[model samples]
Target: MADGSSGDSAPYLRVAARLRSRIADGIWTPGGRLPSRGELGAEFGVGENVVRRAQELLISTGLLEGRAGSGTYVRAPFERRPLLRTPSAAGLPYSGLAPFGFTGTWEADSTAKAEAPPLIAARLGVKAGDPCVRTSYEFLSARQPVMLTTSWEPMAVTGGSVVVLPEGGPLAGHGVVARMAHLGITVARVVESPRPVHVDRDQAHLLGIATGSQATLIERTHYDTGGRPVETADILIPADRWDITYDIALPGT
Candidate 1:
């Protein structure tokens, strides 16, 4: 232990850092059972949620694994793979927006349909009958679909001068967001909401899984600089092997 813990750091993070240090120092050897969440909370005089957040970080980082109701233990030291361009990689050029790092083949339809559904309509903030272009993409990582996203953009935004680009195609190699910016429409904020859902018949087929499987449903809404909606996307990810990292920070000064 060093000097007294700093108040500037969240109690949970401080606790997590201390435990991480212990593990790195070999104090808590690999394949060892670590303290229970409740025990760790009590040790740090913090709530279980705080301890849990810390544990989640370690788990996401491949340092720990939770064994259901049993307890969390140190993960075996697997071969450390080199850092690759994961979807969560910071400042990634296109943010993994394109599937498999390949120029994606576009789809003008939504799951074999020509029009957007009511649920998608609500997400795009458009009228039920409004024309929309749905772009379906599958991104593979390690030879598997690590990310699948379907986006609906208002046809109005695609018409007129922008009409040159067609459906079932990537946006002219300029990137969709960049193209929108060129049209004097700047995306100001991106709001992402993620929830776990049972994979339906269609999802199972596209994702190569059985029905009723668990998947993470991630919905993202892109807003313009004026706070107007520009596009909405729904991404389905198999829960067992996929992970999404969300970083929150204060806006740049």
Candidate 2:
């Protein structure tokens, strides 16, 4: 019992709170070694099991990291990144923006005449065997990878056009909306569905994180005025390093 308890919460939760507070207030430095389980139990006047539970709580939140054959240590904190979402108007210019506020660069690779995946095909209103142009983007913040994105555009809509290859000649690096505009398409609005998912092996390799690390998955579709899908993309952001923000505006406001 650190101080007093509400007498309702699990003893371990209270212990976790106390330990979390100490870590926040700089009682321990990042990478600093933690006291042994027995020592922690003694300090908090709780059982070793209780102390272990508290340590587990911190580990889940990334406040503490355990090393194999070594010991648990304070984990370094990461800055939260914001992904801005605001209402977009028709015929507006497109900006190639990364989700974070970090100073860095993005690399995009073009893959042309690829068979549309089932998911991408459904989003683009095309068959699974339809031809499409795929572009993969890796965004790095301060030379550290942060986000991974894959965009697909149906060749049925862009085949043989100047903007057929998204990362191709002249209009390279321009976002989907702008490239679509090259074909006289007027984008009305974009729809995005976001959820939390574990990073797969491919994503982990790109983001430099452990496999199964938590990440945010965003599915976005670019639609023209006639409600036609022009492009679809999957955006992945590391959960530990970024905070997702959606600036929603209510109708008739």
Q: Pick the candidate with the highest lDDT.
A: 2
Each model's RMSD to truth, in Å? 14.1, 8.5
lDDT for model 2, on a 0 to 1 scale? 0.76
Clashing pairs in 1: 106-168
Q: Alpha carbon lDDT of residue 48, candidate 2?
A: 95
Model 1, total clashes: 1
Angstrom error at residue 165, model 1: 4.5
Question: Which ten-residue region of model 1 has the weakest summed lDDT?
Answer: 79-88
TM-score of 2: 0.66
lDDT of 1 by residue, 1-253 (tens): 5424557887767877877888888878887889888888887888988987787677656677555335777866543222222433434433346433243243333432236678877877777767776667765442334447777777766655543243323455454566677677877767778899987756654543445767778787777888777778887776765445554444692
RMSD of 2: 8.5
**Model 2 residue 184 CA deviation in Å:** 0.6
